[model samples]
Target chain A: MEQQNELSFDTLVIGGGIAGSEAAINLANLNYKVILVEKDLSLGGKMIHLSKVFPTLDCAACITTPKVSETIRHPNITIYTYSEVKNIVKVSEKKFTATLVKKPRYVNEDLCTGCQECEDKCPVVVKDQFQYDLVGRKAVYVPFSIANPRVVNIDIENCILCGLCEKVCPVDAIDFTQEDVEIPLTVKSVIIATGFELFDPTQILRYGFGKFKNVVTAMQMERQLVPTRPYNSVLRPKDGKMPDNIAYILCTGSRDETVGNPICSQICCMYSVKQAQLLLGALPMADVSIYCMDIRAFGKGFCEFYQQAVGMGVEFHKGRVAKITEKENGNLILRYEDIEEGKIKEVEHDLVVLSIGVLPNPDAKLLFDSPVIESDEFNYVKQTDELLCPPDTNIKGVFVAGTSSGPMDIPDSILSAGAASACSANYIRN
Target chain B: METKKIKTIDIIKEKRTVSAEAKQNLKEYNKIKKLILKSLESEAKTIPQIAAETELPLDVVTFYLMTLRRYGSIETGEIDDMDEYFSYKLKK
Candidate 1:
């Protein structure tokens, strides 16, 4: 038999998002050897890319970076970035075994210094996905400035292999022969904190998201408002013009049967309102409008935040946007039904933002073989008792946290992670 | 220099060709890039002026200029008289 190169840990946290980081830190502080596995090159998930979070107007990176740094530097926590858990099998009542595959970054982690020499020399420029394709990144790139590891990974598929990057590296860190490394992990407990993916707006043809240049998603606009924004200022993508009027379409893909997602995304409305306020600050003389079926400000101080936007001269149209059409000058014409006035109205705006919904990422379900991990009707990880024990999955000693269980805001995600960590710790002690 | 460095260079040279689609795309990009560089050879120009000179779409011109700026081939200068768009110049 081949030797199983097995490493053991007290607990395994399957993601490095806000919830996963919180859970890992809590577990590590308890003096438990915890392993945090993240598929991305960075520790902070989508939160780091955001400009500012809702209700607090706090810089999203400001809140996330400290936690990320803490998680990475924690003595009891070991991090695996650019890695995935292939299969996780329940070994016993209290033990689980997992197969982790670490993808090659083609750069030696120990030797590399985070310098831009290789990035500057590379001639191939591709869409920067971290910036939501609003800008170009070289084939060899660190995902963003605040990426935790702050090391560049070569996009092997897109790399022309002209040896420019290899030649420019001060330290001989570029290794083309690097291959994926498989790691077997034995753990006493497992926490699934794999987060959610945003709903793609292209499926809703009526919104004209892909066809219309000025029609951007909420996340894209969030990037534009950030300090490391793709552009120097917020200009409409179609003609590079400073927009005067901007409209927001709330609930783009959520609560709509057509897209097959019927539940409320629980964050789109508040985020849209937040973006509207930020846009007004960015463009002082610009007009902002929001069209929504209903203002579902269900969280603490959320209603006050919505009202504050209204107080700041933001036009809140109680309506449902039916369709959007592009004008000759890259402006947008929105056809919506005004619910309060009971009239169908057509309005023009230079820029429109589609507040896309959150969808459950079902990737964690594929990592288990026996005692098949259960998913609810909406495809989120099933919680046996949401009120009593919110983080317990169907399998014993295994837990689910954050958006892996369902759609939740950042505060809820953190609370969920705490619960999962506590429950796992208790389970381990018993 | 070293044998290991020479081997890496040889591997890169052997495997450096782009795909058909990428090659065609690069060819088109180089064509537009050359035109923009030629137009900016005499003086720095705003995005709209470059668009007009190159007869390219404003979005296309802006994307290319931004890409060039990112790769250190171009740099931004003073804003236009209207204070709307910044002028771009070739990096010396």
Candidate 2:
């Protein structure tokens, strides 16, 4: 691979999600030269895709957009989207050498104006994963309308290579010949803020997430409620009808040893309630119900939020979903053992959202030498002292932040990032 | 010595060769998409109406309709009051 220009920073913050972005901004404010690397084409991370934050029901985009813009505008912070840390080597006690790979956006970043001319001419269409595949995106297009940097990336896997995009490029920024380049950096400290991935509900065969039309994941439902939603309104994926009956199956992939994740995904309960509240507002007449083994309203003001949801007439049923079968009319029949009734009861709904769990980024260890770092039983970065030094990993000068440590909501993730920044800054200063 | 830049696209393509099962699935998807287009040929139809006419699952029909809309082959017309699904017609 061709080597890009060598770069060095005081600190390297991996994963440009909210946690990483916040950490970078914090470090930058401290006058530390920082580098923020994101594997995705954009920097907002999973938080940007969410419709609203729980407890407050604040617009998620409104909260995430400013962080993204701040990270981009920070003079001391060098943001590299569509990039990853390939390898990290300890050079000295508090110094490390890292190799960063820049994945090709297939467009010249410096010259390319964020124009959709090339996208307008591209012919191939495929499922937009950014929108949870609810809508289709061009093979050559920007990630989203509000994407940070607003640069177009060619989905080379789906691109037909008709060269129409190149022909229409006014600035000739479309580069089919672009390649991944490796750039080396030396930093005094490193923060592994690589976030978590949503648990795939298809693994729980009983839920019928991939098979049934009306069955969707909570993340997919969140996408439907966003301002940039694929459909004009929150309509059922099956038949595009405004669903009168909606159901949320909490702990779909969490708290189940069968799926290998037994811990309660802390955000699932609150997020399900938040989505239920939003759904009630969007579909005032729709009957929204949540089936869960327990509602963990443990967070601050979370109980009040739960009460608010109940006040809005959202049903909270304590039960364990046994199975979900699709009816002929595309409605879903959910069979669960109602704790109150002590019997298996069936409820029919037009749409069912699976509140999937969160899992550590499986590739966390791959970014560094495994022998240098240790992962807990759940594969999250092992913190040395959860009570005192929550961000300190097994390796000195390297800290773990956000969901990289464990499942956490936005506020906790941000607080974890703050702890990581402090640890990294202290290490660098020493 | 000149170093060759590694194209990530080639790496992606090398790893993503279509499987026979995937090809079969694609064929099935194209068939369903064709059926949806044919249904829209006569008149604008809501998603549920199309699902009933085509005998395809509602979610499956909705997926095809969205794909068609993205391709600029379908456009939304009037909305049905009963179910609130828009009547989708073939874009002229």
Indicate which candidate wins on lDDT: 1
Estimate the overall C-alpha local distance difference test score of candidate 2: 0.87
For model 2, the docking class works out as acceptable
In candidate 1, what are the lDDT values of residues A1-430, reduced to their tens digit?
1224888999999999999999999999999999999999999988889999989999999999999999999999999999889678897977898888888888887788889688888777778899888778888998899999889999877776677888889998888767788889999999999999999999999989878878999999999999998876887877667787999999988999989899999999999999999999998889999999889999999999999999999999999899999988888999999999899999999999999999999798887987689999999999998989999889999999899998899999999999999999999999
Candidate number achieving the greatest TM-score relative to the actual structure: 1
Off by over 4 Å in 1: A1-4, B1-6, B9-17, B77-86
Off by over 4 Å in 2: B1-42, B51-57, B70-73, B90-92
Q: Please provide, for model 2 over B1-81, each residue's C-alpha lDDT reduced to its tens digit, 9 standing for 90 to 100.
A: 999754444544554564555455446766887899999999999987898899997777887788778657898888777
Model 2 TM-score, 2 decimals: 0.92
lDDT of 2 at A214: 81
* Pairs of residues clashing in candidate 1: none
Best by DockQ: 1
Q: Score the docking of each candidate (DockQ).
A: 0.44, 0.28
Which residue window of length 10 is worst by lDDT in model 2 chain A?
A156-165
Candidate 2 at A359: error in angstroms?
Answer: 0.7
- Chain A only, candidate 1, TM-score: 0.98
Residue-by-residue lDDT tens digits, candidate 2, A1-430: 6797779899999998899998999999999999999999999999999999999999999999999999999999998999889779887887788899988888998878889898888766677898898877787888887899898998776665556777788887877667789999888989999999899988989889888878999999999999888876788887798888999999987888998998878999999999999998888889999999999999999999999999999999999999999987789999999999898899898899999999889778887753367899988899999999999998898999899999999999999999999999999887
